[model samples]
Target chain A: MKNFYKVGLMLTVSALLAGCGNLTNSSLSSHSNGTKTSKVTTTGTSKSGQYSTLLQGGEYHTSAITGLNSESDSDNASNPKSFEAGLLEISKKEFSPDKYFFQEGKMISASQAQKWLGRKSKNNPEGLNPEDNGSTDADKRNPIYLQQLLEQDFYTQNDKNYDLSGMTIGLSMNDVDYYTKEKYGAKFETKISDEQRLSEGREMANEIVNRLRRRSNLKNITITVGLYKQNVNDSLVGGTFFNYGVSSPGQKKVTNWKNISQQNQVLPVVNDEKPINSNDSEDFSNFKNHIQSYFSNLSGVTAQTHYQDGKLKGMAINITTQFYGVAQIDSFTQFVQDAAGKYLPQQPTIEIKIQTVQDPEAILVKDYNTKQYSSHVFASY
Target chain B: MKNFYKVGLMLTVSALLAGCGNLTNSSLSSHSNGTKTSKVTTTGTSKSGQYSTLLQGGEYHTSAITGLNSESDSDNASNPKSFEAGLLEISKKEFSPDKYFFQEGKMISASQAQKWLGRKSKNNPEGLNPEDNGSTDADKRNPIYLQQLLEQDFYTQNDKNYDLSGMTIGLSMNDVDYYTKEKYGAKFETKISDEQRLSEGREMANEIVNRLRRRSNLKNITITVGLYKQNVNDSLVGGTFFNYGVSSPGQKKVTNWKNISQQNQVLPVVNDEKPINSNDSEDFSNFKNHIQSYFSNLSGVTAQTHYQDGKLKGMAINITTQFYGVAQIDSFTQFVQDAAGKYLPQQPTIEIKIQTVQDPEAILVKDYNTKQYSSHVFASY
Candidate 1:
């Protein structure tokens, strides 16, 4: 059944990719060869005493507590290690038959999926790595990766029966032992709402299917930039605050926590695998072409160019969306200067022309095309 | 002839007094009983020769240059011997028989008058009594007094037949010697104009009259009031700047020259003999009475009063004169506490009710009556 589901999911992904236009040339032209990777891991234990048997069909539990066992266990009530150990023992006693599945009703046990996913650990043979135990560096870790991995695993188990649409995503992080710390250390924890986590898993699966259908490099593929929590009082879930095409180390990076809480201007890169090329004319051209294409795609939009001293200076992009119906890109001269100051491409006076967009989807294609691209469109007051 | 003239002068004075109200209780009540006399003596050739004979006629002249020589020899030139010698010498040279009588066929010389007026001298005279010569406090001596004495002699001699009404007075005291010693010494020579000299004479006479009128037993009656020489461009004369009534020795008085220069307030008293009893109800009542009397004496003028906080504050004296037909005392406030917090009485609050007068005497009488007698007349602004 699991093998049947895997085949179905691949076929579905193939269908989706067939409908998408070829973007390989544009992507290839813009990006360099350099690639970087980030690894994230998680660990848990099943209810059964036998590791292989527990993987087949059972409920699982993970110890939430961290770093409490190594110290002397005087009045063990204060130690989280004792509590976690106790909870683990209780969970281990409760045995129920269950299966981990990639797609709906695909019932794949840990023993069956071990080869395709990754090798199981010899010490703790449920295949979950012991090192992938808990959250650390709460602000830097990405929640989307975990959600995507879950979706991918589910799709591998269940193929055609699962629907990834109509799902939402919720991500959060905090330090459980924050008050216990005497110094600046942050003992962080994160919780994703069940509904939101499911939604994110489905969206990520859909993205992967799309990438596979298009025959694009899986390494180069990017999921939708998720909605970031603005601040404590913000009612809306997701909104695009910044674009991520412009890159720098501290410039655009996403984490488990929201940018708003950090009081930081962060732009989460949609395509992190793509390398930035400083010397390539194709890269500059691609940037220019992308900008031009963005302007052309927008309908009912007006482009206006600014000039100073008889020289073309900058452009303003005015957009009329449903919520922020009238929005403007004040001027592009400064941005161009910041982006292209060192390159000195043609040494020509760069001017920008704004193109207003009623349907922003045409200009910001990535936002509409991605499955995880749900946004809370706000109404202008 | 001198006796005959003297007798005639006495008769004329008597006639003038008769025209005025009798020295009955009404008038006598306002004046002091005791006489205040400023006695002077005569000396030089005027005591012995033809010049002496001329002195009987109340005039003197140099018979010959030899008499001039003896007189000049006797003249210390630096320090005048006595008031008598000074007067004799000055009168002989500066005043002649013709000068006194305004004789149709004769002319008087300036040299004769110069001797009596005394040359610019520094030589201290022998047997010069400090009191008589005015040489002890000579440095502090007021030139205004000497000038007044000279004017009195001039009026006594020359204007014996003329009424001294509607006469203008001008007074100037530059302390030429002191000024020269400080700035240019004996090198400075002042060329006195006839008009200037004449004006000085008139002012001297007016000062004498004013001083005589204000005869209080208090030696502190001596006031050094700054007299401003009006520019030729100015249209008005006979205005008081500021006056410091009296001072204890070695004390700083006249500290505020600017306040005096901007003479916006005036305090005129009727009788300096009595102490200013500001706290006494009768004293204020008497003051009001005097003001009313003064106002009544004036003709074609009106008086008004102002009240503040239900208290009789000030009086306004309005006059209708020829030049400025309807002029009102712009401001008049009594019992004002000056900047130094000194509670001075008889601090006259006077504003010239009229700019110029066709019938000044009438206006003057009206103002005097209103100011002194009427309690109802408040300050004019």
Candidate 2:
């Protein structure tokens, strides 16, 4: 009872101190007392006049947390570590305790994915060595390699951690993409997804997190995984949330995970093992030949087709006229669509490069192709 | 020992069955075997060819972990949830055992943050009556309110529980933004940041998450807090990781926490309160008037100033003359720079919106403004 009184007294004193501070704040609030105040935003049921209009046209300044990760300085004693990076660092360091709980045995396996995402060799599909064979450094920057480590390998926070019963292991799939024309010095005419893309993304993360729980060495360290469909435009468009720790999560999850990796971008060189015009296949060369023979020669128009994995997917057609009209565009699209229907038999669905064009960027045509059947979307980026 | 042998024998048989699947996969691998394949992507140091391509622009779909969180089919077979409204209905329906970890206090005291995010004559800056005052349903969508409940507000995951210790609580701040001249049917000529905007964003999320850990009710429930700088063009860009358990583990550390709430678009409200112009003070209205009198008057050049805290920070001057030489542009910029120096006293530093106009988006002249020193920037958005 005596201890309670003492604690209650301290609380009273603190409340009084806080009251003094509030008084100062109230005085500051007077700064807005003389303005032509009208609520700027409304709430669900009532008009909230709580927000005072500070600016209307010219630039307005608002308080923000800056250099949040800047090293802590003791010189400014008024600024507490609890306010800056220290707080984040602390929360990040030990957010998950020595032991946690999660469902077991539910995640996607790269070994299974190795059948496609990894090595072409079936035995090495999951890429037995995720370490980039050519790179001398560890595969820290390799998403696939790091994901392999995250899925197949486990680390425990406790040193003497041998018993691994009743603990939950987490699995995550982090994949990212990036685009920078300025860095590339050339326009890479690539396309991406819409809303459905994001919905599917969470599902992928769910798979990894679910599976990691089943692994044997799961302890202490909490794992988070996801994917990034990152792209670099006039500004960096994707890839956010970075925690300052001893590790680079980006090096693990999604860092340039979406790049059409230079190796994969190369035209397959004809080899002794695989003849170009073999019985069961039609390759890029054949597609290009077909495009040249079928479409480019159509009406004094030159066309370029962008494809991957030996199928015709994207094309840029020059219709001879720069300031083209809707009718001309339709006729052009119709012509191309007809050609695709005939020559590009493998790609049942196709679309034009809406951006790889000059301005006036008029949608002169109603995109006759849309009125027709939709083409299958191929690029996951 | 006999049971172990039986189980081991069953596992061995299953392993062989899996191998048969691999044998079939190897036959499919022959497809790439026919092509000259080389990995395209490089590791940090040297380029590597670790990837294998399967999509031939047609539909060569690879398998992925699906049916994750899917409901069990048999109604009486221990699991009878058949995939909810597409969301995973928790299997641990009431997972935690009884009164779990959490103090009695520490949630948003309806009295404290009744204003908006906090109190201001009874409105929470984050908004009060988060019950969606207009709607009478549960708060499954309101992340902030849910976070508050997860933090201070206590509820039993399952009844028959009374133990509260050694648990940590977490907070999340999920803010997103969008950019779609294509979707909104109109283009709001709002200028945002190149990098600093991203820096401030993480800080906001950090603040929320950090504060949550300090709350009394912070235990057990792990909160993953974050913000997103989202834009909708061809793809969805932000806000990914989410987990519901004990302890908040925010991911992607800080991505985009503030991009202006989409809800605020509803009103162009002007508020009423003591117009704190202080009779002789520099206030929001004065700044607006100053901008109107100064930059809006410049002939042949339409200018816009983006400010924060009522201080002008950015001015985008669009001159009709393009492909026009730099010298003439310098004269134009000088005229405006001089006006800014004289009129917008609060804003010492200003920048060019490098993307607002056509080519020669390049800085035509060294900003006389830069030689003149700079000021703090304030765009809370």
Candidate 3:
């Protein structure tokens, strides 16, 4: 009986890893995916003969994979949020919220992820990073090739359970790798050139995809890969997914890699090259000037602009005020809303975070698709 | 020279603890404080003769005392946020953002807090809770009194540094204490009566205040104490600050306790006692129905209402939608804003969290001090 049970478990594991059914050209269209929305017309129903429910429920099935929070100390505060949001945004192109439910990565184990994130060594073979060369010099010499690996899984509802239909993996590479000279010594950094970073990222992503294809459960699922160059340690904005590629089911590796032209710049670009769009800067300047004029007690007013393909896609403005009362916050929020409508571009999404030195005061936002702005002021009592 | 340095350190600590310059009746106004906003006539400056700056700069000086994240396993998800926000809210009455800068508690160490939270025993003389009876039965025979302790310190600017002027402490008493009969055994709960909970919370607060007064750094600072009753584990909303008291500078114990009639109720309340205000329920129901009529794809539309002294204060509505897309989310958010404006009372602060099965879609809010509503829809790239 015990032998029969062991055999049953093995068969189940094999079926989970090997099963690939109903692969079509349309299902493979997520390949070569970018942020561009190309409308796919359907009969108002998914291939499963049901209307795709965008996140049928709000709670995501927690990751079956462990060790998500293990290497938290090594992560930048911005990397985790930006990496996950960007991946889900990218995945929407192929999996579409209408069709797939979201879940944290389950296929990769902690040991597997740790190995891939480490320097390739003779003793350990699964390392995707290049082998380290012993060097003390950091600025222009030896650099850590990889920083972190994030995985997100997309699922489709089956008869009783959700089937793993697609996966998105994000590889965060370092622009400046920080290392210590000796145990508990001064920290040093090695700057990675753009060319070296992109090339290494692409190479590692391809190798990772090829490797996962060898696993039975990972053999026939659609895989999307994004390569991100993490921002400098002191940078205010997080890094972007600079490049992406996709591997279709039954494929061995990723191909046709596309460069994503996305950049985040602090507004009032000083001591730097001219912004990609002069109009965006001018509008932001006008908006800032208008709010600054209305309120003289403001600590600071600044914005971070997001550009895609050299076009202003969004701007998140931070307005720091010295005021505390509900009356003061409400009045300032009203004026800012009016200023945003008058000065900011209507095509790009705009967000304004109103805050004090102690806590968040209010938040105002405008969606790209609509002219109306939405806002919320926190309650004090 | 080493002895001289030691003497200087002792003098500095003595000065920090015993500095009681300019003690007056006006400075003691923070005593017997509540949510009531009784306007104080200010000469455009604080007692220090400095124009009160509400969090002068946006960044708060982090906590000097450590052990904040310890015992996180014993905390409820909502308790941390509510406790901190509520304490800050209570502190605002006395410390006024205009006068004091916010900081995490500096006087109380982690070990001291842990000691106070444990059951009083001969081995641990500092424990504030009742000594354990060693009974196996949890429901009627055994009970745990306290759950967690949180502290916030407020500071006033000095010549070179911010002087600690006031401090607030939150004692989170459990409503239903969960315990295990044996190691890794089945969990059991002891339902505490309102009389037992409040009486124990008051006693602990008094004991805690007296103990804190003996410390050098904590002795002269004005201390505010709030007693909070944590909600049941399965409840949707967090607990409320049910009572508060204050200790003037140089006082040893909290006195003149005031009952805070604050309660949070889920809207369209079912199988519960009559709501504190019928108008609030009607407004929420109308708002929910109106939005539901406009958006049929919503999974659920519910609200949590906050009341104080039998008067409606705030309502946080969660609109879970099945829709995905910029156009759909924007439209639904617009409709929610319209319905909120038409249905919800103008005096109460209103917040609407628009979400999908996967991620946040948008947010709409109305400040109690203003009629205009603010909304923001999440940008999906």
Candidate 4:
């Protein structure tokens, strides 16, 4: 029994070392002999119609499933001596990357999916995304059907003048899991780039938009995609979201985007192993504390720090006093700015909001990193 | 050597099992036979004259140091058995915490610390926060001294009418280590209610604040304290902050607030163990996806989600269309709200913002958690 288990491990390792090609493609095919041996495959739904072929059951689980029968368990139950029939199972995610699939820059609502899917078609009356009538153990995630439905919807929202002559839309259910695992809830927000894959995200967005433009959506619609960071501390709560695309009303002939194999170019800014405690970051933190302390000594002023990567991203100070003249405001602003410049080893971002009777409201913003300074004084009586 | 290590292990366990008073109080006093054994101590600055008494050197580290006397014999010819006199050390953070110390919400300027400390008051001439002149091995952190200097500075910043009659102010250099270890710099902010004694944070805050107000500052400065969740995926940054005292234009003759004996009541909301993927959290996550999908069917709309404690906290949706009337916006908002109300197992906060030419900017915010709803419409040209 021990030797047999060791063999299972060896086979799993062999399959792992031989990535992408052999293990991913081969299924139910015999090796040297015509022995009906089973290999744990990533595709849960097998053409052979035997659910046991999945080895780890239907769930997209984490970690390895040990001592699992790859073939039908009926024979193992009848023949207790057949312990060699079991195979080790490694999850698909274990062999994959952090990103799942591309999400649309614009979120698609449940009603839209249902309505588009329910659109009367010759193929069937009830729409595509309907609940499955199959057994609970069946593979429930149907990526292809959803992709087709989305494409059809995009077609419905466009016009022939835009010309989506030759675009085959594909859907990937990968983002469904991506959303729940990386984000906080059930909301599907493809527009969010929580992982900081903006350039790559833009590539995907362009691919979709360019294709849709060819199709017929808005005749002259130009969409600008933006990816913003999520504001939650927990991985499940936030990742990223899109600020909703800005649309310029117009139709233009589009071209020059290509769909590539699951390969992406942009990467995450690999944070230093000890980001918070790194010397540079610590300096920034100390700077913030000292600045806050210094500001406190000054009368009628309060400041809150906004920090990122252990550096002082920005400082917002509120001053409560009526200014006698522009010179006074300038002097005070320069004083604070000079102090920040002197103390910080790096350029600092400072924002000042002032309140006074003559200048009822005013704001001064300085971005040392960008070398840009902006100030506005509201004129009011 | 192995037998000696075994004995050391047993002694260590004995020390641990004995708990605080026995292990903590017994430092230099001779053990059993007075073999002149060494013990690890928390004071980064040891009075043993050999500043190198700390085997780990001078780094302000996190957690306890393990193992000691690692130098090879050839180098320690003068005291070959120096190994016999060494012990493992645990830094202050690693040592047990009775309570998190109160951080002065208002930061003090270096000049102020220098001035009050440099006063010809016989006790200090160079100022309390002067750069260290002693050798590097001395305890790098000096909390007690800083705390005292801070008290003096506060007196300088306040009015003379208030009797600082019985006030004693102390500065905790606690923030220095906190900034370095948790963040990246020397800013001191220690509201750390360590995981072990979370119940004690509020106690410390109150203890520090009550004493501070009585210290001849403004007599009636009411400080507003805010405890915020630090947003970090690693689960550390978030804590609490103090919004400096509100003086309401003039000081009131203050009275009644007391400095209690290290005891108080407020507690942290200890979340359920598996907050990230609780069934309820997942359900909410899925519901979010479903809602986004549903909302997609509607024309001109988008939503943002805010969640806490593995549950939906609030969902804010924005509609981009010119509403013909309030009734139209209400109908659409109600439709989305009703769907959330029906599916969510718990009350969900829902906020909706709509744009129309007549009322280009309008906001409808609903706090289901607090059972409050608000709407404001800005007049248009």
RMSD (Cα, Å) for all candidates, in order, is: 44.3, 33.6, 17.0, 28.5
lDDT of 1 by residue, A144-185 (tens): 222101111211123223221111111111112121122555
The digit string of per-residue lDDT tens for model 3 on A43-151 reads 1111221123222122212333322432112445555556656666677766776667555565777777887777678976877766667767765455677887877
The stretch of ten residues in a row with the least summed lDDT in candidate 4 chain A is A81-90
Taken in order, the candidates have interface RMSDs of 53.5, 25.2, 17.4, 29.4
- On residues B1-381, what C-alpha lDDT tens digit does candidate 2 reach at each position? 111100011010101111021111111111222333321110010001111111111111111211111110111110111111001111112223232211212343333323323211233344321232332122222212211111222223122222122222222222221112344343222233434334443444455445545554343344433222222222211111122222233321323232322110001112442322232123323433433342342223333333333433333333333322221222223333333333333332333221113322212111323434111110000
Model 2 CA lDDT for position B159 = 21
lDDT top scorer: 3
Q: How does model 2 score by TM-score?
A: 0.19
lDDT of 4: 0.28
User: In terms of docking quality, how is candidate 2 classified?
Assistant: incorrect
Model 4 per-residue lDDT tens digits across residues A265-293: 01111333234224434444554453344
Q: Which stretches of candidate 4 lie over 4 Å from their true place?
A: A1-381, B1-238, B241-273, B276-283, B295-335, B343-363, B367-381
Question: Top DockQ: which candidate number?
Answer: 3
* Candidate 2, chain B, TM-score (2 decimals): 0.25
What fraction of the native interface does candidate 2 get right in terms of contacts? 0.00
Tens digits of lDDT, candidate 2, A1-381: 111100011010001110021111111111222433221110010111111111112222111212111111112211221122122212223333223211111133333433323422436543321333343222222222111111211122122111112211111112322212345353332233433334444444334334433443332234433232222222211121122122122122212212121001112233443422232134344434433342232232333333333443333333333423221222233323333333333432223221113321111111222323221110100
Kindly report the docking quality category of candidate 4: incorrect
Error of 2 at B99 (Å): 40
lDDT of each: 0.22, 0.24, 0.63, 0.28
